[model samples]
Structure formats: structure tokens, C-alpha cells
Target: MTEATHDDRHPMTGNRTDAGVDTGIERHEYDVVVIGAGGAGLRAAIAAHDAGARVAIVCKSLLGKAHTVMAEGGIAAAMGNLYADDNWRVHFRDTMRGGKMLNNWRMAQLHAQEAPERVLELEEWGALFDRTADGLISQRDFGGHRYARLAHVGDRTGLEMIRTLQQRAVDLDIDVFMEFTVTELFRDPSTGSGGTGGRISGAFGYWRETGRFVVFESPTVVLATGGIGKSYQVTSNSWEYTGDGHALAMRAGASLINMEFVQFHPTGMVWPPSVKGLLVTESVRGDGGVLKNAEGERFMFDYIPEFFKKETADTIEEAEGWYTDKKNHRRPPELLPRDEVARAINSEIKAGRGSPHGGVYLDIASRRSPDFIRRRLPSMYHQFKELADVDITQEPMEVGPTCHYVMGGVEVDADTEQSIVEGLYAAGEVAGGMHGSNRLGGNSLSDLLVFGRRAGHNAAYHSMRTKQRPTVSAEQVKAASAAALHPFEVEGGENPYTIQTDLQDVMQRLVGIIRTEAELRDSLAEIERLKERAKRLSVEGHRQYNPGWHLALDLANMLVVSECIAKAALERQESRGGHTRDDYPTPDDGWGALNLVLTLPSDSDSVDLKHQPLPVMPDDLKTLFEES
Candidate 1:
């Protein structure tokens, strides 16, 4: 691969005439419009409504089926009574350690402290978390948590949580605009003249079912859109996880932090090619499953590093001891943090101990009885049975790491959840600086609830205190509509599915669990090629609910975000957390404390990389840690 200098041109702003499509068009309007309807968006809408603002949640899927429904594990919270040692401080420390200390201290601090209240609020709104004999919420152990701090309702935690929030939002009469895809943000032209400059006035998108363009005119817009795992070939993320919010925010000139740190879950099923990369939740390992090679040898012991060495057991006896007496000993070997576990699996495969499939075996059949396994891992049993024709109760399941979550995204203030953009806010996976480099397993759910509500409340407050600048002009709306429709108008030269598949293959090969300078360079070249293909991409059918056409548009966003990741990875010359560059090999102490900011180019598709000074913790904030 050839090394190329970064271009400062806005690739999305090129002339459309070359592609045989018109670019000129009209704009549409809303009071408060949210692009995603997952846990974050639902929570945001609810908070906005309580703040006395009219809100509408526009989503790409049905109410509950958004990716949040697929989150099987649980939400992390500091409901302290479950484990006496577990508190907000411990939670914060575990989060920072899990993220390799690259996290925004303020975001991690706030998330750890406020998460319990959010979880309890869900309970008040009718979420039925599993309860102990004392009737308090039951807690479960997950990867990276020092204590059992995840509140759950069996394996369907996200489903239960989203359902509760959705029901509550309905009771409050928040408008639900399902099957709508936001394509662009509309800034008031008059803002630069007399009003608050650089504030997002509203947003616009197409209604999939109606095949019509819809515009929302609001002083505030909250982006709760999720991760970019869909950019990888083998991922656990749903179609909705296309990094829409990240792309939109970047395009609107909001700074993105830590775009390179993507988390890869250690145990995705790896078998028949069709279901090879589906997520096998950490709940499997949480229930006593061990990672073993085809030789039936457990391998994690050899790979435990100093950071987790004390917290991880080596011998089988020590592992069993740790499981039984977790407080006195380390966590069970099976429950090591995700990055460690994934690296262990990688070593196993590299050393020729891998299973028939290019993956290792995660077996619980030998550890637990079939009846107990059936009761606890019903979904795993059913998933393998339906998708791969295998049953976990009867056999060892093959598993490997698949791209799962992005630890990087739009930068936001820890307390306000506001992006650098004045009227813009972000939460959930789209907002960054919380997880840092590697996210703990259960923290994501809690982060969404905690920060999502904060974003909503803050956005509503900004909306109430400020006035709308000006309505979007007809020329602006027409241009956006034309741009939204361009892919459909082009004659067939490229298939979106083919382009997407190629893009994913490139990402998986170059930016997978491991990385090197050579691979990173190759990945950047591949991204540029894919971007060229995307420009000529065409789709079958009209602007109606056409998945193919929608994918074409999504491909552009994914490519842009992927480029940001590659570029950021290239700039960060250290191996801290998820961004382990073989060439760099070790973390730089001076660089470790800084945040990498990827600012969008004023005229092009490339991102400008710069190191921003991390915020220092004040005495009052430091005191919160001491109190805990």
C-alpha cells in the first residue's frame, strides 16, 4: 500500500452532475427531533418531555427492535447494597481501568455516580429487574467489573429496559416517528448574522414508509444514535448501528474524540459462515464457561498481564477459588476483561490450538449441568439451535471476537452532554470520552441511561432559554432533498450490497482486533477506493422503504467514519487500550493523559487530527471520589 497525504476536501460536497444526478432542491421542520429510538433516544425524549419541550423520536426501525433490544447482558450501576464493596468509586475505577485510563475522567465519574439513580428510575417506571430475597435489584458479574454491579432481568435486560422507557414515553404523549432516517442537519442561515452562531437549528430526513422528506425545526437536537460496528464485516451490531450520529456530528463540525478505539467482544459464534459472527454474550462466560483450545487446554493463564494479573487467577484450583471467594481472590479466569480474553483467543488461534473453525471453544457443558444450563442460557441454546443447528447444552460452542462497540465518538461535556457545537448534544454510543479505549461489558447500558437523560434535560433547558434563529430557506431544503434523492436517480453502475460487503471486508482485515502500521496504511488506501465506488453507487427501486437505497446512503456515512478511525489510529503513536499498534508497542506517559480530537476538514472528506488537553479534576470533583 502506498502512503498518501491527508486531503482536506469535503468529499460529500462534490458536484453531483458527474454522477448524472441533480443536486439542487427544498427544507422541512420539528420542535425536537431525535434520530435514534434505542435506549438513549427513548430516555432523551422522556427527559425532554419532562422538561416541557415537544419531542419526536424518529427511528430506522420499529419501536422495540432497535439494537437496544438485542443487548442481552445487563446495565452496570452502583446500587451499593448488592455487594458491600461495590460503590460508585469502585465502579469509576473499574471503568477507567477497563478503558485503559484514556476515558474522560468527568464522564466516567458522572456516569458511575448517576447510573444508580437512572436504574432506580427505570424500576419506578415499571422495569422489573431480577430481585434478591430482600426485594432489592439483583446484581450479576460481567467482564471488567471488579464487583457484581450489573442490575439485570435475566438475559433480556435491554428489552425490558427499552420497553419500560417506551411505555413511559407513550404515557407522556411524545410523538413517535418510526421508520424515519435523518439525512442532514439544517442550520439557520440567519444564525451567522445576529443569532447564536454555529448552532443547529433543526434536522431533515426521509420517511421510509411515506417516501417523503420530513424536516424538523428545533433549537435543540439530541443524537443518541449508536455505534459503527456495522462497518466491520463480522459484527454483533444491528443494521441500525451505522454511526449515523457520529457522521452527522462530524459533518456539522463537532469534534470527535477517540474514534480509533473500537471494542471487540471475545465470544461471537464462529461456525457456518452465515452465522459465524453473531454475538455469544458474555453471560455465557459469566455462568462458568471456560475458554479452551481444540486440545482442551485452557489458555488464558499464560496471557494475563500485570494490569490484570492480580485480579485474574492462573491455575484451575485458583480459578475455582476465585469464583467461590471473589472478594479475597481474583475474579474467575473466565471473567477477565474483554480485551484480555480476546487477545488470549487470538494467541490460541495463532499457536495452532484453535478449533476446526478458526476460533476457540467456549464450553459450559462440562462445568454446569444441562438442566441448569438450559435454565440460565436459554437464548444461547435457542440461538445456536435455530441459526447454526447446534445446542449449547449438548455441545461446546465455537466462538471468536467480533467487532462489538466503538469506544470513540462525538466529544461532549461530561456534565451537560453538549457537544462543542452550541445547540447539539450527543449520548449513548455516538457520544465519546466515556469508555475511553475499551468499554466494560455492562457499562454501555448504564451510560446510555445516565447520559441520555442528561443530554435531554440540558438540550431542553437550552431550547427553553434560547429562541429559534430562523426557518431553513427553500434553497437549503431543496438542496438537502436533492442530495437525499441523488442515489436513487443514478443509473445502475454499482450495487450497494457489493460495495458494503467490500467495505466491511477491508475494515475487518485491516482494522480488526490486532493492528500494525502496514495494515493501517492498507486500510486507508482501501477506504479511499471504497469512497470512490460509493460515489458511483446506485440502487434499485424508489426512495420508499428500500433497504438497498438506504444502505447506499449509509455506506457513505460508514466510509467517512471508517476513514476517521483509520486516520486517528495512524496519528496516535502508542499502544494504549484498544489501539495497539505493533510498531508503537507501548504507551507514552505524556500522550496517555491527552484526548485525540478528529476535526472535520472545512472543504473535504479528510479529518484533521490534534491532541486536546484533557480536563483536570477540580478539588470538589476529586472530593466525590474520596467520599465514595
Candidate 2:
């Protein structure tokens, strides 16, 4: 309800006790250290540990509290439980089409092929999915999937996923540093590691509870820190998703691709101001819920994109038939990729057909039975009942768009998940190119599963085989510690919270869902102002349980990421998927063929953007798209 403040109970800062005046640093060593405790981080740690290496999982929050735990919907995998005709090729085709063909071809192929095995592995490791009559893992329909393809535990799929992965990591004896925030990644070129130039040496950070600096010396680091939704005022993401991994990779000399695309999910709560942007799962619409404007018109049919026209239903009757007989009828427009649905919702509201709460109406009450609603979407029912006091099985809910995911992040090798910066690897939401311009619902969970394992496996091999482990020098650690504590050293400077709020305002107003060149340029100018203010930002409290201090550190990451988003948006002058341009309203073939790449020059803090050609797809894979 209130604006984001330093006083909120922060996940990174656990209960703090006075370690009084003890500034002494702590140090540890590992072959690989995974930063983040979400699904990807846990999976990566487990894999690296299994690969005969010392692995550590460091996180900003307590175990099981990562942003992945908040994911609704389900993990997408073509297990064909509900439809025997379904397979990986179909899943791949759906993904590429959903992403508007800008996705990295190799990554999409790998994700589709490996997702099934990953989901089955989780099932083997005690992840209980809803089962079909034949006892196979039940797959549920989600937007952009051609078949029932999401393996789930009702609507709380992410909670089940994180719990299973967390338990597996614990059973595998992986070391975990809870409530620690990694502020800088250290790369030592002088160690003569077995990679080009310099390899990842280690990470420098602090214990959130004690504020004491710590260092972990390692040959490899896996950055699984999640999305950049915290940069927006209204988001489905938690407070922790402040572009940490993306910023860390950029600062460590990696390039970021397609930084313009940010996904705003179609159905977020739009009432009661406080919970306005809280997510309303796609599973509701997948299960036959309808979207309507204030005039009681099913508005989605009128807003269907030409790209999806051939496969989507044109009438309400045809769309309704799909829930009961998917084999014969086309999917509803409401089931279009998130970008289309979000834009449609925005249009309805802007045209003054919005609900009393300033959003469109989503009604499942008139379609599905009360028992079916409760059984399939239990979390949705409870979320609305408790948070908004509106029983979803009885009436329509006010819903609109909210910033949910980013399709762009650190660019990495499709095969190894290694960024341009040698020993640094990335996967999940932090790695770009997998989702392209727009990500399909349910695809993110699968992306995490498929690539997380790959990143961990390769990072471990790289660490173990390095002739000698790289070490972080005392000087490097001291410099990092000084930079982190600089906010406390400054006096009478701008408040970090003010700079953060200002940055969010600029992003939401100018660089959000729909953008133009002038607005993006303005956003960049504002971001520069914020960056200057951030450098002079001051924090009053000591680091122990100090949310103000944490904000100061996170503000730097947000500013860099915000600039990346705005600059990339400006470079790609066409509307496509998540990166919709108000002026240049159509997708351009030339722009689609090239990606905007952002690299940070070593000599300067500013980021430079360039256009890079996309990789050519293999003929075998190209033929898949030609098939009817």
C-alpha cells in the first residue's frame, strides 16, 4: 500500500545482534560459488557438488525465500500426459513463436529438449505434481503452449519447485551462506587460470546480519540472481529482484543482449492500491476465465494480433469451446503470449472501458464451477479472498498489467551458459536470449531447470580443471569493502531512497510497456541524473540490519540496469513483443535480425550499445518452423 521504504522487514537482513565494532573480515574458499538461492541457484549448487567440486550457495535471504518461491503458474515441459501427440518439437515451436522468433535458436532447442527430463528428475526427487488418470505427471495449459504442458502443484508450482531443489541441495551436503549479499565479483587475471585472459577469481560481499565483509576465492562463479522488476513501481517481483546478477555480469566485463524487453503480465490485481500489482496467475485464464471491459464485452477478441490470428479463436463461442474440446477449437485470444494480453489490457483501460478499480475484468465465476475453481486455483482464491476480500469463485476480479519478467539479461554461450567474461556463468532469469523479446508463461521455470544444471556442470568442470585456483588479494577485498561502505562515510548527501524512487518513476513513466524515442532518451537523461545522485547518496544507520545501506548498494545496480533498458529500447526502433514502441509501431525485419548489445568499458562507468547480428539457425531446426 505504501511506497517501498527502508523500514519494511527486509528478507536480506535477518534478525541482527550487535557484533560491536568488529570490522574484521571473514574469508572462505570454494571451487565454485553460486550467488542466489532460487531454483536456478539450488539446482546449480547441487549439480556442481555432484560434479566433484566444493560448491557454496550464497543468498541475500533465508533459504526457500527467494523470488522463485513467489512464482505461480507452473513448470512447462512436454511430457504429453494430457495429449499423446505433444512432444519437444511442438514445445520448441511454441516457444520460438511465443518469443516472436528473436530467441537464441540453440538455447530454445536445448530448453525444449531437456525440460521434460528436468521435470521428471524433480518428480523423482519428491516433487509431487498433479497426476493424470494414468498416474503420469499432469500437465496444465498456460499461455503460448500448444498443449497441456506445465507440470504443476495446483497454482503453487514455484513453491514446490524451490522446496524440492532446496531439499536436494541439503541432502547433497552443499554449503550455504544464508543472509549474505554479494556486492562485487572479483576476477584475477594474474592467477594463470586455464581460460582466455582472466577467469573468475572469487566474489566479495558482506554478511547482512553482521555487516562484516567476506570473500570467497573460487575459479568459477554462477550468477543466478533473478530479474529487474524492482526497477518498476508496480511489479509482481519481490524486493530482492533489483538487477543484481545482470549488473554484476556487466560490471565484470560481460555483454548483455536484448535489454529492451520487459514483460508485463496481463493479470495483476488492480484494486486496493497496496496490492495493485500483485500477480493474478495465468492459470486462471488458461482454465477458461474471460477478460471483459466495463461494458461487459469480451475485449480480447478485438485486440488479437495479426501474428496470432491464424491460431486464435475469433468468436466467444469458439474460444469457450476450447476449454472442453481443445482438439477441435482454436485457443482464445486471452491465451496469447503475455505481451499481447498485457497490451490489450492497457488498451481497454486507456479507452475508458476499465473496471471501477481502473483495470479490465477477469471473470471465472460465470464459467467454471465453484468446486473446480477451488481445486485448480486454490492459491488464486485464497490470495484474492485474503488480500482483496473478493471471493474469485463468485464474482469477477479487477485485473490489469504489471511488470513481471525481463527477457533480456547477461548474454551467455548457449551451450555452456558462460558469459563473455570467462569463468562467470549465468542461467535462469539473469541470462538473456533464451526468451528473446517476450517470454511465454511457464517457460521461465523450465528455462531455470534446463540451463541451471548446464551452468553448474560446466562451471564445476572449469573450476576443477583450472591448473591453479585464482585467489582474491587483500588489496582487492579492501577496495571492494571501501566502495560498499562509502555511503556511510559520506555526510549531507542525497538520500538513497529518493534516488531509487526517482529512478523507478522515470522507468515506469518513460521506458515502460509502451515507449518512444523521445521518452527513452529522456529516461536515459534522468538515469544519468540518478546515477550522479546515487554516488553522493548517504546512509545514516550502521550496516547491521540497515535497509538504508542495502538500498544504497542496490541503487547502483538498478541505475546501470535502468540505463541498459532505456538505451537498448532507444536503439531498437521497432515494436516487437515486450519492447513495444509507440512511434515505430511495427516489427522491422532489419531490427529483428540484429540484437542490441550493451558492454561496459573498463575505463568508464558508462555503458556502450552496439547492434550485433543474430546467429544463423541450423537447417534442421529451420525446417521445424516450416512444418504446418
Report, for every candidate in turn, its global Cα lDDT versus the true structure.
Answer: 0.80, 0.87
lDDT assessment of candidate 2: 0.87
- Tens digits of per-residue lDDT, candidate 1, 33-108, equal 7778899999998998898888878788888787887677889998865688688888988898888878899899
Give the per-residue lDDT of model 2 (tens digit) for 442-507.
999999989999999999999878887777777887789889989988899999888888888999
The estimated TM-scores of all candidates read 0.91, 0.95
List ranges where model 2 is wrong by over 4 Å: 1-23, 191-197, 312-329
Q: Indicate which candidate wins on lDDT.
A: 2
